[model samples]
Target chain A: MFWRKLLNIDSKIIYVVVGLALLLPVIKPVGMPVSISEEYTRRFYNYLTDIPKDAVVFFDLSFRETGEAELGSSVLPAFELLQKRGVKIVCGGQWQQAPFFMQSRLEKKAEEIGSVYGVDWVNIGYKPGGTATWRAMMEDFWKGAAGVDCNETKFDELPLMDRVRKLDKETFAAIVIWQAGTPGSGTWMQYAPDIPLLAVYMGGIGGNARYLRSGQVQAMIGGMQQAAEFEIITDCLGDATGLLDAQSLAVLVVIAFIVLGNISWIMVKRQDSLERSS
Target chain B: MNMDPLIMLEAVGTIAVLSYVWKENAAYRFFEFTAIGLVAAHSIVQTWNNYLKPTVRDRMIGDGEWYLLIPAAIGLLYYTRVMDKKFSWLARYPISISIGYSIGYSLAYSPRPFLKEFRNNFASFGHVNDYIFLLVWLLVVFYFIFTLMKKTKKTLRVTGAITRCLIMIYMGVLFGTSILGKFSRLLGRYQFLLRDWLRLI
Candidate 1:
């Protein structure tokens, strides 16, 4: 009778229990351990500190819709690092919603770090032609980006572009890009030859670890695990750390369920076989 | 309650995705379909912006190349399956080209990396840790070799059982990891609702 009752409870109850358990913690996060990688430190930021003040460093926002969780937290610290240093920034988009989303993230950090805009930074909106745009930016930042700014003010009017009218400034610093597949690491490497580029890919488009080791990308932070690590290293600085703790706990619970299920099923089968023999 | 209308909607949208953990119902499906539709529409627009407008448009009409029409024609072949059979053959044209180009690209790219991985696993480093890993690796590889034989031996059975157990453990870990990963997203969605939008906290 007990076994029969156990089998009879509606699956709905299970769903509600699991859902609430996962959801409640997220609303009220209990901070957990995060294991941030050394690669992100060395590859993306180590080369960045040397760039002189007011050197143009472009931040490429690569999130569209699906890749936000994996991409967002990983890039947060890097943005904070750039803002604190008082370096000039040129921001743009490779994904549609990315610019709008990152505008807020950058603005919040800028307030904290006291980085000035138009004087200290600017955002150039999206453009067509992935490879073509990279080539245009390399040859001329204004030709493809003409009459565009982070605010729709003409690109030429920006003070940051004043001395560097030709887009061929040798002193320009670096381009840090986040990638989610198309127009990925290959395109920029092919067209934009130098100016010290760094990239992070947050999705399965990385192909595999083997491709990453080929020097195509300077650095990479992938999946939720890496993002959690970044959050831990930065002392749970961003909101993403909440998700990490929830995920680790969820995994543990699921594993326990699967083992128990298999054991129960095996026991039932054994009892049935014994009864038939008797 | 505090800020922009769109931010509230985005927060609601996130909670809708998380609602699935409670039940398989209409809200989750709506969000899933909306996400899919938006992505598909966005991809089409992006392809036009990135590929069609700059390359084919400027060259086709502005420069009067006439050669751009060929690719344009091949691209239109996708609609042929609905109405006609003969035109369906055009689909092969792009597939063949894609396969050919990818083959060429990968051939040039894959050799060194492939050799490096192959050598890394097989070649012993002479360290204690390295030897232990190498021994397990070779044993696993050889255990798979037993599948080739029509008959089984006592020795093969032991190794086969060990390999099977290892595989099960690996699968269990992977399943657990996936569940945890998904729950993380659900948690984010729930947080957006409770703290950011509702401000109940």
Candidate 2:
């Protein structure tokens, strides 16, 4: 009876417990020890840090508002890191909201450093075409970007644009994609495989072990776990690091629920068998 | 209390969506509908601003590239699907064009990357882990063989069973990671609610 009662508890109770698990860490400061996973995040961190100054890094912002939670945490730090390195970033995306999301972070970081927009960085906004657009960008950057900035400012006017006229391996030192869905790093890898392509994938889509092994993706930062590692390496404690405690608690709660349910199920099955035998 | 109406709205929406975890109710449905409506409006505006405006202003009128109108006309035929059954076939032209282009483009580029990846898998046999990977990869591939006739080898059957077990383990790990990913997003929302909205943190 106890086993059945335990198994039959209202789902609402579980929901409230999970909600508390997520909420408690935010309300209280518990500095959870975050472990560094070197496989992907370290590689990504090294590539970002080691890139020479005045080198062009193409940041493809491919996430929308919904993805802001996960991708934005890593993105802000990435911009900060790039600014520290004094890298000239050519920001573009396939998603329409990407420019606004990406530019806001870059501008915030640039402001702290007193970096001029047109000189230090340029955002061409979202090019409408997907794969075809990537191919065009590879062929000719100005043409692919439609020769206009996110604000409809001509590319010729931007100082950074003077250097980034095309999208070849030589023209750009590296490309990093903060990606969620299609027209993302996958599209970039297919169109511009020769270039050193790195990606920060949403943890849900971070299942491509083969790509990492093959070096198709030069490096990758996947999910918040990896994002926390990147933050540690950069020595910048940001949102990803702050949220790590909550992530750990939430996972623990879910696992506890799974274990409890399984144990109850087994107990109930055993009771039923004993009763039948009697 | 948060003075920002936007933050207040966001908190309300978050709570409403999260309400589904407790029980499906009108509050959850209201927010869900609002989200869908907002996304629909956003898509329309973006498509107009990002795609239609540029193609018309820059390519067609600005450059006097009248030839751009041809594809535009073809693209317009896609709307015919909503109009009539007979005209629905007109949409097929654009669809076919897109599919054909994708297939051709993928065929041209995808094989080289795949082949390169496959070659690397074979080349990296120096480590003990490399042999395990190769074995798992082959077994998983064998598991996908749908043409297993009655006369199939016993070894193949045994490999298929082992592959299924391996796949289940792999899937479990993937599932765990995905849950962590989703929970990270949830944590982000909670952070916003507590720190930005309620200012509790």
Give one clash count per candidate, in the order shown: 3, 0
Interface RMSD of each: 6.0, 2.4
Model 2 lDDT per residue over B1-201, tens place: 587988899899998998788679999999999989987897787667666787789888989989988998888988999997988989999999988988998899888877877787677668897889888987787678643641468777777778889999889878876777677667777887888888887
How much is the lDDT of residue A187 in candidate 1?
A: 51
lDDT of 2 by residue, A1-278 (tens): 88899899998888789878977876774887777767777778888888998898888888876566678778777877887778888888878787776677778778987778999888888877677877887787887777788888988889789887678889888888987666677776667788898888776434676677777888887777777777788877778777777777888999999999999999999999999999
Expressed as tens digits, the lDDT of each residue in B7-87 for candidate 1 is 777876776776675667887899899988987897787556544664555556767888878877776767666667866
Pick out the ten consecutive residues of candidate 1 chain A with the lowest summed lDDT: A203-212
lDDT per residue for candidate 1 within A168-250, as digits (tens), equals 33746666776665665555444443445677665222233333444444455655666665556544366566666665555
Relative to the true structure, candidate 1 reaches a TM of 0.69
lDDT against true structure, model 2: 0.80
The regions of model 1 sitting more than 4 angstroms off are: A1-10, A32-70, A82-100, A110-229, A266-270, B2-4, B11-31, B56-70, B77-91, B110-112, B120-127
lDDT of 1 at B26: 87
TM per candidate = 0.69, 0.92
